[model samples]
Target: MTILIPSYEPDQRLIGLIHKLKEVSGDPILIVDDGSGDDYRGIFDTAKNAGCTVLTHRTNQGKGRALKTGFDYVREHGIKDDIVCADSDGQHLPGDILKITEAIRRHRNHIVLGSRQFTGKVPLRSRIGNSATRMVYAMATGKPVQDTQTGLRGYSSEMLDWLCQVQGDRFEYEMNMLLEAPKAGYDLYEVPIETVYLDDNKSSHFRPLADSAKVYFPFLKFCASSGFAAVLDFALLFLLQWMFGSLFLSVIGARLCSSIFNYTVNRKIVFAGRAQTTARTSIPKYFSLAVAIVLLNYGLLHLFHVNVGIPLFGSKLITEISLFLLSFWVQLKLIFKSA
Candidate 1:
């Protein structure tokens, strides 16, 4: 297996990690100098002297681009071994790196993650950021991953092409990998690793606000689309009910119109490039879901208004609120599941 380290304005800690890694494994270590400039040339020279294939970028590119550079090099050179990508921030220990490589060897087709358990004294930013991301990731993909921000990850040779094609350039690229993994047909395996924070992770280049926005942008877009569709649905239902005093007709008219809008926005915007099946196949499934939801929505509205003695508008509002999350979940996990 090959070890790929993407370095940008790195310190001596990276050199130390490289030396340690060399002692542990005889595999080739490729370091991408992501525009570390002339001042850092000596360090790259030292790494080269100590036997590392160093790749250079004239200008600083994001971590994702640096990683793609390394993967591209491996593919161009026809290196067929699995690759283990480890961070140069010294947080990823040589032992843990070896563990990830071993996991890749054992599970050849799986993407192995060197997961860290956040126990003991973790930095406040790290804790909150990871927690928020974990929750959002679970909600969006219906998958539970302990550490979504870990940099020590392993990928088999077959995944190199796909990894190169995944979207994003900064920290968001890593998040995108985890989000798209299930849809891309890759099983995920986590290997426990040491959680080491140097000076409370002060060396990390991640811009919390900017990068977090990019990471959560897709889910946020989905919410916006759904919210807009819900508003349209409610307005139509109320208007149609007022015009023609018929709950069934109102429900059907509102759902038919709203479902068309929802499906278009979801298929074209919210879950773009993540569809598991063709539009022809998924459209029927989505229509079926819309029909079922319309029936359930009407039933709940009738029960709430007649049996529970709630006002018609109040029942409509309650029923819509109750089904909001379920609709999103079903569309995400089933309707738009990656084929």
Candidate 2:
């Protein structure tokens, strides 16, 4: 197995980790210096002297780009060995790295993750951040992943190209890899590992607002599209009901208008279906889903408004919020799914 570590503004700890790794395994270790500057040159030089193949980026790109650079080198040189990607921030243990590497051997096509239980004294942001992302990622993919932000991961040589193609240039890139995996016919396997946060994870370069937004961008975009459609649908429903004095006619007419708008925006933008998915193939499937959602929407609205004694407008709000996740999931897994 080959080990790839991407580093930026690293310190002596990185060199220490490299020396310890030398004791753990004799596998070739590749390090990508993500614009760590001349100040960190001593550390990189020490690492190079320790027999690591060092790759440098002129300026800081991001962790995702740094990882891709390492993977590209492996591919360009025709290295057939499986790769284990670990963090240089001293968070990932050498033993855990070997564990993920072994898991990759057993399941070549699966992306093996070294999952942390987050036991003992853990940093507050690390705990809360992992929990939030774990929940959202589970809902988005319909699968539970223990550590959504772990850097100790393993992949077979065959996955180099696909790994390079997955989106995101920073922290979000890792999340995109998980989101895009199932669509590409790959599954994940997690191996339990020790969770060590040195100095309360101060070495981490994660940006809370920017990177989190990118990680959750897929769902956020869907919400934006849904929010627009919901507003239009709500307005149209009330107007039609006032004019025609019939609930069913108003519901159907409003849905007809909103679904067209929703489908157009969703198909062209949000979800950006697989390359082969064209308007010719997507339209019928999309309408079929929209028709089903309309029926369900009406049922829920009637149940809340008539049976449950809520007012029409209030019922509309409740019903829309209730069906939001299902609608997004259906559109994601069926209509605009990547195949």
Residue pairs clashing, model 1: 276-338, 276-339
Candidate 1 local Cα displacement, residue 319, angstroms: 8.7
Q: After superposition, how far is residue 186 of candidate 1 from its true place, in Å?
A: 2.1
Q: Estimated TM-score per prediction? A: 0.82, 0.87
Worst 10 residues of 2 by lDDT: 271-280
List candidate 2 segments past 4 Å from native: 234-254, 275-281, 294-322
lDDT of 1 at 106: 90
lDDT of 2 by residue, 100-186 (tens): 878998998999989999999999988988999998788878899999999999998889999999887889989989988997878
Give the lowest summed-lDDT range of ten residues in model 1. 321-330
Query: What is the clash tally of candidate 1?
Result: 2
lDDT of each: 0.90, 0.89
Looking at model 1, residue 80 earns an lDDT score of 99
lDDT of 1: 0.90
